[model samples]
Target: MQMLIIGGSGEMGQWFATFFKNEGYDVWISGRRGRSDVAEKLGVRFTSTPEEIIPECDVVIVSVPIDITPEIIRQTAPIMKPGSLLMDLTSIKKNPVDAMIGSAPEGVELLGTHPMFGPSIPSLQGQTFILTPVENRCEKWFPIMRELLERHGAHIEIITPQEHDHIVSIVQGLTHFAYITIGATLKELDFDVQGSRRFMSPVYEIMLDFVGRILGQNPWLYAQIQMQNPEIPNVHRSFIEQCERLSKLVVENNADNFCTVMKDASVHFGDTGAALHRSDKLINAKVAEFEELLQSIGKEKGLYHIYSGKTHVGIVEKVMARSVDILESGKLVNLKIENVRLLNSDELNAWKNDNLAAKTRDISTYIPENADPDTLCHILGKISEGISCKVHDTYISPDGRRSATFRIDIRQDIDINKIQDDIERLLEGIGCILR
Candidate 1:
């Protein structure tokens, strides 16, 4: 099967290229610059324009930013062959999907998709891909698309174009705006991350990591996420109003009123049940801190609930020596931990069953392929600026295969080629094979 990736040099585009290439498909990437950077890196063919590549492909997956999605669909529609599928990966669907419906030629299939994760996760092991099929003929391509995604481990969800955008107005649109605003606020405050690390709590560290993460994503992409959807501004308005309510409660020093508001919001946000409470390490540290500060303290264990997913995985009625509030029996335990990064489903389950004390890898020893000691350290410094994976160790085997493991918890939907090519290129520079 031939797959053509419009905007093929983009991060997501590169991800799809690597994915199809790995699956032994004929993958060709086309982009505006006419440059084939991603295809070259993945050792796939590349084209400067869709006109040169579109007719030859069975599937055309457009991975351009949301703002340009409509124009891209218009450009691509006239050129797509009949019976061929044309789909886009834009986050907001209504406009682009509508554009595709209006622009696509007769007998051609049109669909819209949102993979629901960044290129950070390549495997799609547990990620969801939302699909909105435009017409009846589009049904022919749905199973083909689903099969390819499922082969790479993505969960599929089908929704209409309108429903897709309205829901994402909250999930993608609101969330992106909030994170960007927080990142900007931090910059304005001139918050020194280095100094803060000296007194880091798990929660605080996680929040800092989140700020850095959203900040590192493409500025233009984030801007598109903020502006492309018309419903986002209203969501943003509601969020700000809620913030005002919280601030008013704090300023008035009405603890009871604040608590009531929290209860009401909690009831509205139905408990997902899979939330983490405190890691065992965190709880112990908190207890120790309280003991040091107070002369007298209770000696009763706190309630903890372990979660595998939406369902309750395990629960700890007590930890043997610290008094704590027991909320619902099957209620979420870690509902208050902000900026908490997620683990893959399997790792999460393992850690939860083990009571969250699982050993984490230390990244200091990791070396990059053929990188000078100084360069390796610099690369690690750059990587440390973000919240995701970190390199663990780099080694070249006797047979010439070079590899570097990482200390990161991998997400199912992350595009590994983004990093894999870096490693491969580095190894090739050092005259090593991938084996």
Candidate 2:
């Protein structure tokens, strides 16, 4: 089988090309510049033009940004053969679906797919690929596509184009729009995140992870999603209005009104369901399990929480196993364990006095020097998105160990479990061990 990916030099294109190549398919990557250097590096073929690639491939995947998708579809539509599968990997669906439908040959199999995951370079192991079936002729290729995705460890779901966009408006469009707006606003406020890691909470750190991803993603792609989806503007406006109303209630000291508002909002979230659906429930579950193990290790060590006054800061002391090496250096150090919890001062004092092998000394606390940056970023990104952690900055110790700090205003109670996984993921990103 042969696959041709447009926008091949771009991150998502590179990922798709890599995915298919790994499965032993003959993959050709095409981009505007047609440099082909990346393809050579990956031992794949490269073409500069879609016109050159479409006629030669069985499957043509367009992995370009959403804004450019429609034009590209119009341009490539002319070359697609009657039986070839024409697929778009853009994040938004409706516009591209309309464009392809309006432009494609009668017998061409046009498919609209949004691979739920971004450029994280993860295996399909438990990832989901959403397919929006437009043309009936495309149904024949659904089996082949499903088989390919399943073989590579991906789960597949089929939905109508309208349903796909409706769901994505909430799942992708609104979420990205909110994070990008927050990240931009925060950046403008000149928050010094790097300087605050020592006193930061795990939850705030996770929000930063989410903010950073949308901030780093292609702005045009993100903007296109926010703009292309007709339902998004109203949803975004409603959220803003709700915020305004809440602020007004607080300013006016309207306790009864605020209580009513909060209660009404709670009803909307339901008793057990979160507003957002799990993107990769399987991978997230695995991450949660790993995090639980880390917490367990901390608990075993009797690591108790440290506080500044009445506020919980972090864990300072833990039950030391005789076999576990406890080093006392002033420079930053990276430590890992299976489980931990925030300890009260009394608990921390007990560990410090009894179990600690030495006086509490700081070797700057962070991840080990050997951890991978990409992994660290991924973990941090997840935390930022999954837990609403507002990461302000990242820091590196003199020894080159890394750490990040996030800030959050706790006006109301929040779930620590929702935030903890991202926190641990961020630590793992920097090769730091979490206990």
Give a tens-digit lDDT track for model 1, residues 188-227: 9998766876788757765677777888888898888778
lDDT for model 2: 0.67
Give the top-scoring candidate (lDDT): 1
Kindly give the stretch of ten consecutive residues in candidate 2 with the minimal lDDT sum.
356-365
**lDDT tens per residue, model 2, 120-174:** 6457888989988775768778788879888888888888888888888889877
lDDT of 1 at 191: 85
Return the TM-score for each candidate structure.
Answer: 0.63, 0.63
Candidate 2 has a TM-score of 0.63
Per-prediction RMSD in angstroms?
18.8, 19.7
